[model samples]
Target chain A: MEATVALIAEHFNGALSPTFFELITFANKLKIVTQAKPTIVMLGEEIEEVANKATHFNGFDVIAIEVPGLASYNPETYKAVLKSFLEELKPSFVCLVQTSTGADLAPALSVKLGAACISSVQEISSESGRITFLRSVLGGKAQAVFSAMTDITVVSIQPGCFERADTGACSGNVNVSRRAYRSLRIQDLGVRPGPGCDLLLSEAKVIISAGRGIRQKQNLALLFELAAMFSRSAVGCTRPLSDSGWLNSGSQVGLSGAIVSPDLYVACGISGAQQHIAGMQGSGFVVAINTDHYAPIFNHSDVCVVCDVIEFAPELIKAIAKYRQVT
Target chain B: MRILLCIKEVPETDAPIMLDQASRWIRDNNLHCYRMNRFDECAVEEAVLIKEKFPDSILDVVTVGPKRAEKILLRALGMGVDNATHILSEHTGYLSPFITASWIAKFASDKDYDLILTGVISEDNMQGQTGPMIAELLSMPCATSVIFERISYEERLIYVEREIESGARHCMKILLPALLTVQSGINKPRYPSLSKTLRAKKLRIPVICSDALLKVETRERPELIRHPSKSRQSLILEGTLSEKALELAAILDKKSLIK
Candidate 1:
């Protein structure tokens, strides 16, 4: 049967992240009734932006629904309006690429619409009529596959796993429609920047963070000097450092603060707490250095160093400088 | 104030889960079964605490899942809920979350519940959207990640402590008929007492069929494909303890891993 899958293109200042190429690629792989095209539903101008962006990667045809002024994210309004659209279209399958916010809305919207939801899917496919979804569980230690028996199934694809489609251009029709639901009473609380927030915490390409072993706040400069050498990478601290006021609230990285998945995470003098691990766990590559041989971070890091920061920090920075001069 | 606590039965969080040969879904273990989600147990305990405060108010616990979901309702009743309801159906796999929310919302809509409470997220899916979703369907106000709750009868308002960024806490107040999604570690959910378990066995649970709850519309199927094999690019460190430590530090520093 022909399927109409809606991928709610999340809007960030009327634009979409290029990473959503994973969603487009995965959605294109589904087996549906032949002779009918898969319809892509997007809300707001970002839908058009995504449609335009997706064209650059693949010549896939996407029909977009643009709801004007659909700025910011609202689950209730989205679900309400989407429910009405599903009632009219009655697509055979629906899919969403999992992001922090999309993950929250996927299941609830599916329930309100009476659809089976397959969430956090890293892989998806169908044979005959049955659909299978795959994702990792227990902090990426294991893979779990889920299947749905319903005629209509909804899936939320995980981010970062799929290849982003190369930018390409395609032609698509744009339809502007009003969301069916009444205006939401809830207003978005704008992002509030806190005080003493080091500019680095918000904009760092790389982060070198210290944990409990740093021992003293004054010693932070030792780490800062090295951070300066590394293309102005930012210095951050674990909860203990922030709690002790060794670093400002903005510099704290963990469950309670910024859940940064940076390009590279360098953890120093830190005994990795479980909460701390959750925050930095998303890094592309993790290297942890701590004197305590039993530091928990070693379990989670790509590279682990059991060394005292005081002696190692100075010499390591000096050695790097010397190595750079020779190389 | 009357309260409705929605619970769920999920795969044990710590268990080793495997997929079946179809590569379509989780394999069923003949010997093992599901348990009431740990976080929902907290919601039940919170409702129990409120019932203890206003002994005159009623507490109705409801859950929607397959036949096995009765386990959650039975456990809730044994924990001191005045009544229990299970919206029974075989649609438990991928659709369970949505079906459960719809069933609970339908069950709660006609009833007079001063407050609706559920776990912020189930350990199984861990998506943390059902409470707010149901609240939206019912057109009720909803808030998530609450650690503590207080009810003011005189003011007709409920105040709750919510966890925030940087281990901070904030208090929020909402009128009755509000929904609160609870965070873990809010309060310990108690084990059912032997006497209570025995009494629970005698309580009758009304099972509502899926069609009776709400109308559902099905949509797209996710296309599934084979998973790729991953190669670990690993670097092994070896030497005397101090030497290894220093070498590792040097490597990290050179890589700019240690600032």
Candidate 2:
């Protein structure tokens, strides 16, 4: 029987974000899901904690690797420990979905395990026993396909590629084991927080995005005011604004910048470059306000207003303020 | 000191990238196929700078790609890398970070190198896997997203300055015989000279396969899901530029979108 193992974080806190649940959605769709019960390899206590919340779920088995000391992500250790588990189980297919942490570890794990891996895969299908994989390339400008001869395949699906699974009352069998880090040769000095605002890029929902529009640094006040409408949203910008040092580098969104998939994406004065589009392509709704009708952003916008933001700024603010007062 | 800098050959991003109708991928015809990713180029540039700083050190470029990738290696050689090793694998088209790492780690294991370097992430996958993954396979240390730095051979340590959130920069120090993944802005990679390119053409390379290093772990066939093109009716936003602006303001205000 072809057994499939899904490598996921254990903390099943029903509160798993779209990125976390994306793994579950993909795993359930596997052709092997019906024939062979899928098994999930959970790392650390948080993932295990989440798994416990989801033990009643159907469609797969849940195994937790008790690496208590692994409070933070270390690529070397995750690869070593995951590789060891993989070697022991030798599942037909092992899918490692990418989170910020998994993206770091999946490649190293693939190398060590001598496995065929597909990174940032959008979809997978098997026919006549051969599996074909597909992924986006060149900052989402193109997609590529690849096939492997080995029976075991490692893949890290991109976030937002699949419909999220409902976590209510789902359960599966659980297996717990302790991990030995003998395969890992590296040691961590410690986890140093990344530089800047420390804004959680993955969790942002409402975003006020800027581009070449605002014209100058002082013009960012307009974006800040827009962002103030939603408690969950933050301000973002295209590469130009971030590159020119006019805005916080952390808030930049594009292929070279942070990938943001907010519920509401407000692109202001931003000429939508392809590279920039790749980052926010997954946003739920995009509203672009630009003066130029030929701006490429107008082509992709859900709602577009062709007018000068500079001329409309004060009145828009006043109107919203009035609305807020009335409400 | 000996260093193995891993490079990849990717389609130039500046060109108009369009997929062939038959296959669901970009048609790489007349499009320029040369130039490593921006970040990998930065990594190679860092290696060259390191070599210049320490004339006694030797820098070797190694890449796990098809025959076409050798063009990049030769380009690196012409730009001043001593020599290169191409672990030739025909099936590299499906070479994920894991498989690429396996091929690279197996090759690196054979060579006596004091350090390994790669781009923080390739513009292609943007996953940034090889450096850290190879470190795990070889059981070595790794640091990703390094923007600027200098390496010390004597102390076997790397001093790095990286940009992070809020325009903040952090200085980090990591011990070597370690792996380093650099971002594109670190250093602009140089152009290879004609003479160096000629000399590099004569250089010999070694080709290896993943099968020789480890057993077949698995071959996953990922499906290519095309993002359907969405055609939106564009309302050419027009009017007495100022009046149009007011009209747009009224619309935006009605939506409660912008304040």
Candidate 3:
């Protein structure tokens, strides 16, 4: 195992995603387990700045594949360029953050390069001398540990799994490679900014979020009432609630939704899927209410109450009201 | 138009599931409590919607699973799918997404499907690999996490809106012979109509032994299934429902969260 290359993810709109820093951490971690050298890879048009910044920050050599894809990420183009470039490098590991782009790219790239592909990995463990990637399966109900069967492995690290390690010891060298690509099968149209983008999510002091456990649309009033109990609070929801039209997309909280770090997060009926937890785990304090005792929400909660949200929210609302009155 | 949809049969999310630690695979498959993967239900609905708009199009739904997997195909058929193909396998254990995608790709390659669609990720595996793998195997374009799409018959292209981080979306124009993995909430999946359900029941579906498909080399395998590592205190508040609520309120109040 020579090099563990961490590919920096760029947002579809060409902005650099923050997940790449975590990818560097994961790459270094995997480097330790495999005794491989660590490298950083970035793809975009004129990415010298990002590459150099990462180089100086992580103290790892950067491979900057400069292509003319700034408007949007073209999967076909990425696949074409990376297949050729990575084939030459033949690195032991190719690490990417499990964002929408990474999730879409990892499997296809693995098939192209004849590498073992693991998706949405949240943790890494070494037993004896062998290493395995651990990821949640069955919708966060359990965990699965997987081992690569091939020489080259492509692993997508789940977002929010690894804390970005500070690395400014020394600047490494950058290797620039310019490539040209023409897509015959696909064309970029553009991006539609999500509707109902809630600025309140970022500014709110408290967020009361709903999930599938809320059961029905009408039950959401309880969460709204709970949110009203606190000042500067707003109602948020998991993807399912937004998908069901019970709430707008802007009010949704998760990896693909809004990412908020309020002082207090009240999770109602949320099962605590990694996608949902990744967004709100930065909250100062957390409380979760659910009927399922094994609900994953408990894992991230400061206080976990094993009761139906429908039953619990009203009581919490009443208790908070009474406490406020007494004060 | 010829469209192909891939689906999976998974344990119902609400079912009481117990893990078999020795085998490292969850059990209760012996029972009949199974349903289509929720993400795939959205795909099934999307396929039906496309079929409705293009009434002359042929909609084929395929699943690679064990005997019990016929459930998804039947449901797809009941939802107005024209054809159902079951690549049968008895491997009750976990099947790598690569292997599953390879089998379906082999079956669909010669059919020359104009479009292929599936759920962004299966609830059971959450790998989100099969759809893109199929497209790559067939040398076609691919997209994932598609929140909305519309087909342009004249241009022979499918325009897609793929959701990215924070609900932002990237829209792309995919050539006809492309694959799209639909995200949840792309559409509300509808239940089967009584007439369609009865008609689908009477129709015998075509089944192909998964072993018959071209051998696919799997890149990874699960070594163990363990309980997820806890990231917080995970302290369970034990008491009656009201007592638990009041306790939570007290905890928040102690932190001065309630004012």
Cα RMSD, each candidate: 8.0, 6.7, 1.8
Give the DockQ-based CAPRI class for model 1: incorrect
TM-score of chain A of 3: 0.94
Q: Rank the candidates by DockQ, best first.
A: 3, 2, 1
Classified by CAPRI criteria, candidate 3 counts as: medium
Model 3 regions more than 4 Å off: A1-15, A68-71
The model with the greater lDDT, 2 or 3, is 3
Candidate 1 positional error at B123, Å: 2.9
Interface RMSD of each: 7.3, 6.2, 1.5
After superposing candidate 1 on the true structure, give the runs of residues whose Cα lies further than 4 Å from its correct spot: A17-22, A31-36, A44-71, A125-130, A184-285, A288-301, A304-327, B7-95, B98-111, B129-178, B183-231, B234-247, B250-259
- In candidate 1, how many Å is residue B167 off? 12
Residues A287-327, model 3: lDDT tens digits: 88888887878888888888788987878888888889989
TM-score of 3: 0.96
Ranking 1 against 3 by DockQ, winner: 3
Per-residue CA lDDT of model 2 for A190-306, tens digit only, reads 334443332755576678888777888888887788677655778888865765677756777864467778777778887665557767877776778876654556666776777
lDDT of 3 at A78: 87
